[model samples]
Target: MTAHSRDTPQFYLTAPSPCPYLKGQFERKVFTHLVGENAAHLNDLLTHGGFRRSQTIAYRPACESCRACVSVRVRVDDFVWTKAFRRNRAINADLVGADVGANPTSEQYSLFRAYLDHRHSDGGMADMTVLDYASMVEDSHVRTRLTEYRRRGPDTAINGRGAGPLHAVALVDRLSDGLSLVYSFYDPEQRDRGLGTHVILDHVQRAKALGLPYLYLGYWVSGSNKMDYKRRFRPQEHLSPIGWTLLND
Candidate 1:
């Protein structure tokens, strides 16, 4: 018998389920638990191999007939800042993001509930309770951080921290190569603020400042309207069977 250490990750496949991105299709996933000391290092390797972390599990699409899910990462150093991107930054100029430990709070849950209620009422996470939300944020074994976005305070210039009510929240994982945006939510009522776009833009700048080469944005399903926004971030690389390929257009 092979001497397999408990830390050695064992991958499993999930039963097929109805596909969320496309109609009349099913989705399956191959996943492994990201626990123990090697979790962070394993996460980096798996992420590079097109896996995404959700809590303590890293999973990738393993559908038999479909290959629509493509892993994407924005090239932080070569990001294209268009006029619209600049405009979005201006719109969210008053907001400041502060990174804190991965601890779930009631305020965050409220915003999360609102976001799901308004945007994803029929989604899998639509009925997530407070406990479920906490597990999502706190159950991670890898390096995870939560960035809360709020209005700039009087001492914002000096402290670089936000004040006032929470506008948005992003749960991110700090990886060896770059930051992976695990999940994010915002106040749905403030649609004009473009909080979602701002979060991605802010992370892009943050990744560049930190000298990271990529900002992993999870999977991008082609032909899905919900994922169309990801295509706007030009100068990005999509993971293919051949390897990461740049997409300028």
Candidate 2:
């Protein structure tokens, strides 16, 4: 038997379970633990290879008969802003995002719970307690940041952090090539402000400012109402068997 280095990731396959995005279908995943000194580099490679990070695990869908979950990354330079996007941006212009450390706070937990209760009541993470949420944010071996969004106030620029109640939050990892958005939540009642859309727009601009080329938006599953919003961000590249290909329409 060939010996493997301790740093070499050992992949595992999950048993088939009901698909989260698609109805009447099952899903499987090929995953590996991101740990040790090589974790960050491994995460980068796996992300580039269409895997997503959850805590310290990097995983990608490996269903036997379905290929519904398509990995997508927005080309920051080539992004085309439309009328609706502009309107949404204008609506959220009062928001200021602070790129803070990945230390979970009680305020963040409160917002997370509110978001889950209002938005994802029946989803997998609906019952996650404050500690579970903390683990999700703090138990990562890769470079991560929690971008806290709040309504801009007089002291926002001076302190480099927003003031007042938190409006939205984005948990992201900084990569050599781009910013991968791990998870995000917002004040559900402020749907009219399009907080969700604004978060992506803000990240697109942030990526451009940081000289990053892509903004990874996790997986886009077709026919899933929950994932339909991802289609609006255009000039994105979809990962396929051949490689990442441009999606114009």
Q: Against the true structure, what is every candidate's RMSD?
A: 1.1, 1.2
* CA lDDT scores, all candidates in order: 0.94, 0.94
- Displacement of the residue 45 alpha carbon in candidate 2, Å: 0.6
How would you encode candidate 1's per-residue C-alpha lDDT over 1-249 as one tens digit per residue? 888676899999999999999998899999999998999999999999999999999999999999999999999998989999999999999999999788899999999999999999999999899999999999988999999999999988898898899999999999988999999999999999999999999999999999999999999998789998998897899999999999856
TM-score of each: 0.97, 0.97
- Predict model 2's lDDT versus the native: 0.94
- Please give, for residues 1-249, the per-residue lDDT of candidate 2 as tens digits: 999776899999999999988999999999999998999999999999999999999999999999889999999998989999999889888889998889899999999999999988999999999999999999999999999998888998799787899999999999999999999999998879989899999999999999999999999998899998898898899998999999967
Off by over 4 Å in 2: 1-4
Candidate 2 RMSD computed on C-alpha atoms after optimal superposition onto the true structure: 1.2
